[model samples]
Target: MATAKDVAARAGTSTAVVSYVFNNGPRGVAPETRERVLRAAAELSYRPNALARALSFGRTLSVGLIVPDIANRFFGELARALEEVAAERGNILLIGDSSQRVEREHEHIAAFVERRVDSVVVVSVSDDPDLSAFADAGIPVVALHPLSESVNASSISIDYRAAAASATRHLLEHGYRSIALFNGPTESAGSRQHRDGFMDAVRDLAPGAAVEEHSTQIARAHAAQVALDMLARPSRPRAVYCATDEQAYGVLFACHRLGLRVPDDVAVTGFDGTEHSAYSYPPLTTVRQPIPEMAERAIALLAAGEERVRETVDFTLAVRESCGRHGTDVAS
Candidate 1:
């Protein structure tokens, strides 16, 4: 392996000068000297030791991300958007998938802290995740979900309750009297917001209408199974509002299996309008999170080096074929 000493010799400079060039310095090197050292390092295929550099500069120029499940299309799209923003700022992004496990979330937090990543963006599995470890280590963090006020970290998220209400209200406007809410597992922060918004809309629109709540895991397959059973019932809902596009797709599949026509027999609205949502069989009507804008703003906030600011972005509802709407109209 090529060493810093070899590059220093090749550049005709002291090892300390090479260190200053690579670490961006406690002391400045002349621009010409910096260029010479960089050229020599490149020619020699010399890479700075990340550990040594971190010890000197206290930054890895990298951001750590922890998502509950990367395979989920929403998280995958979020990761891609965050990566683009991070890259534009000359930072590398390291992703850790928790796979819906709290232990794994903690493990990733520990790993990122130990590795001294400059900042982190986390979408935690738990409603109130323990992030004091990162705080103690002086790592800046931004949660992409509603966090407890006591947690004392920056958060960037849409108003889930309001967004859910807008989606459900759209269904009500279409005169779907029998509506059901297919939400995430019970007792979750996200699930509760979705359910509350859904019920609030239904109560205001049709006081005596049949409204029910169904819980399922965020996975499409599991939600599909649950929806199949639910739709098989004679009292199945005429319209459904889902907390996520994944679950809405599952319901769509169930409708297909039962030979039911969408927006004719059943209308469905989904949240988290990923690109794939538009490509579904009936072209879903869903709530569109400003993911790219949110990702850019989150990275900017973390990079700003100011810890006191928290930001919340707005969401929009995309009306399309599935919810008895023909054109793509946005409601904010």
Candidate 2:
């Protein structure tokens, strides 16, 4: 393997000039010298040492991303989007899957801090995730969910309450007098927002709508089990609004197991419009969070500085077969 010294020797330049050319640098190299270094590097296939650069510049040129459940389609897509954006910015993204465990989440946080990642993007399972570690280490954090002001971090998320309300309203428009809410297990800020939004929609738009709420782990199997019992009730809801597509999929499974037809017997709507949602049995109608846009903005904000800003992006309701949309008409 060729080294920077070999490239510099072939280019007839000092190692410092090579460093300036490769690092884009503290010191300027002549245009002609820069071209020479590039040509020699191409011939020698010499690669710069990332560790050496990081040691000198105090930046790993990497971002750490922690998600509650990587197996969930929503987080999987989010990770991919974040990785793309980070790569475009000349940085690598390190992903840590917490699997809904606080201890595991903390372990990832510590690992990132030890690795000296420039910043972190987190989707924690806890309401008040301990960010003091990152704060003390001077590593900025950007959460992808609703966070309290006391957390000492920035957050970028869509208005979950409003989004949830909108989805519930869609069911109401379909004349679903009885609607059920399938929310996440934990009582985090994000969960509260989902609950508030769901109730608000029922109160404001469908005052007479009979509403029932249930909670389950984000896993599809767990949600399926919870849904099986819910749908088996004599007073089962006509429509269900899920906090996530994962849960919605489980609801669909429960519906099938009970020999109930979708949109005919019961309708369902999901949050997080992942691509897989499109391919679900009945094509789920969902609230689409802008993953690419959110990822790009989050990366930009974290890379810029530790400016404690709470940002909200736009979300859209994707009308599809599951919600029983008539013609081109969609429930918003």
lDDT of each: 0.88, 0.90
* lDDT tens readout by residue for model 1, 207-278: 888988888888888888988998999998999999999999999999999998998989999989899998
Which pairs of residues have clashing backbones in candidate 1? none
TM-score of each model, in listed order: 0.93, 0.90
Model 2: residues with Cα > 4 Å off, grouped in runs = 4-21, 24-44, 206-208, 327-332
Q: Candidate 2 lDDT, tens digit per residue, 1-332?
A: 99888998999999888999988998998899999999999999888998789868888999999999999999999999999999999899999998898899999999999999999999998877888899999999999988988898999999898899888888898888999989987554478889999998889878877888888888779889998998998999999999999999999999999999998999999999999988999999999999999999999999899579999888988888998964342333
Off by over 4 Å in 1: 23-39
lDDT of 1: 0.88
Q: What lDDT does model 2 reach?
A: 0.90
Residue 62 shift from truth in candidate 1, angstroms? 1.7
